[model samples]
Target: MRVALCQIEVGDDPKENLQRMIDALRGAPEADLAVFPEASMVRFGNRLADVAEPLDGPFVTALRKAAREHHTAVIAGVFEPAGDRVHNTVVGIEATGEISGSYRKIHLFDAFSDRESEDVAPGAEPVVLDLAGTHIGVITCYDVRFPELARALVDRGAEILAVPAAWAQGVFKEEHWTTLVRARAIENTTWVIAVDKAPDRSRPPRGAPGGVGRSQLIDPMGTVVADLGPFPAVRVAELDLGVTERVRSILPSLTHRRPELF
Candidate 1:
């Protein structure tokens, strides 16, 4: 499948942000799927309570329209209302403009100098959406730090991992981001499609830049197939799923696991 990774700059306006993503999709290479960064609907670091919307709300509705117009499957980060706190979510829409599914970010960004737990609720399940002849798993930004979650998705028959993140910028943070992304792909023997948003100057955290926007795609062997630098950009690449089967056949890590001992 051909995938387009969007490294976009977002702002406070939901309408404008949606348009930005649609524009990127329109200009992308003929692709089966188009992926956007985390918080694609609205700007990140905003008050979750004020911006949180439901699955049928305007944000997702607009995304569905874009998917139908482009005739490509779309996936991106979103915020959904869940009780008192919002759920950091990733919603998938098929080329037919139908809601595929949603993944609520299981790991909240409660680390470093930020506390996402204060505004967002943690999810209990992993979401896998079948599209373009492959099972694509979903996870949000901070969850990339955990390997167990990626393994769970692989166990559920995921050939690729989809990550939508607004990765915060900090000391050694970029190093950590790239390392974890490659590690997950290598261990799982699956392709990784990671899209990150550009730095938001209006919403700096701890007196520093908001996010590091280095969107990239990694193959099963931990080789980067495409990388979009820390800026507003979009890149497309054709992925061969046969490579995943070949890598897994050699390593056989999943079958070699001695679950009883662990």
Candidate 2:
């Protein structure tokens, strides 16, 4: 399967962000899957409640239309209304423009002096979407730090992990992001499609840049297939599904785990 990683700079306006996403999809190379960064509907450091909408809202509805028009499956982040707070969500749309599934971030961003749980509700389940005969696991932003979630998704037959992040810029933050993403791919022996937001000057957090873009696709053996630097860009690469089986045959780490002891 071919995948397109779209690194875009998000803004505070939902309509503008939606249009930007559509434009990116329109201009991107034709692929089976296209991914965008977290909070693609609106950037962070702003009131999420102001632009939070349901799955059936205009933001996602427009994305569905764009996905159908482009004939590419999409997995992008958006905020969803959840009671008084909002859910940090990643919605999966099939190439046929149908809703595949949604993953509300199970692990909220509570570290680094940022309190995501204050305004965002935590999710209780891991979601995997079946698109074009491949099972893709959905994880958003901070959830990439947790290995247990990725393991659980692999256990549920996930061949590829779709990671959409709005990673903050700080000292050693870029290294942490890259290391964690590669670790997940190597440990789980699953393909990782990590797409991060581009540097945004309009919406910086704590007087620093919001996203340090190094969006990449990693193979099961932790080999980076492609990396889009720290800027707004889009790149498409072919994903050979058979590589997972070949790597597993050599390493076979997942099969050696002793679950009873842990």
**Candidate number of the best TM-score:** 2
lDDT of 2: 0.90
lDDT of candidate 2 over 87-167, digit per residue (tens):
999999987889988989999888778788988999999998887569998888889988999999999989999999999
- Show the lowest summed lDDT stretch of 10 residues, model 1: 202-211
lDDT tens digits by residue: candidate 1, 2-72? 89998899777788888898899898849899999888876656677788899899889988988998888
In model 2, where is the ten-residue run with the lowest total lDDT? 201-210
The runs of at least 3 residues in candidate 2 whose Cα sits more than 4 Å from the true structure, single-residue gaps closed, are 204-208
Instruction: For each candidate in the order shown, give its overall lDDT on alpha carbons.
Output: 0.86, 0.90
> Which residue pairs in candidate 2 have backbone atoms (N, alpha carbon, C) closer than 3 angstroms, thus clashing?
none
Pick by lDDT: which candidate is best?
Answer: 2
Q: Where does candidate 1 stray beyond 4 Å?
A: 204-208
> Model 1: how far is 203 from its true place, Å?
3.4
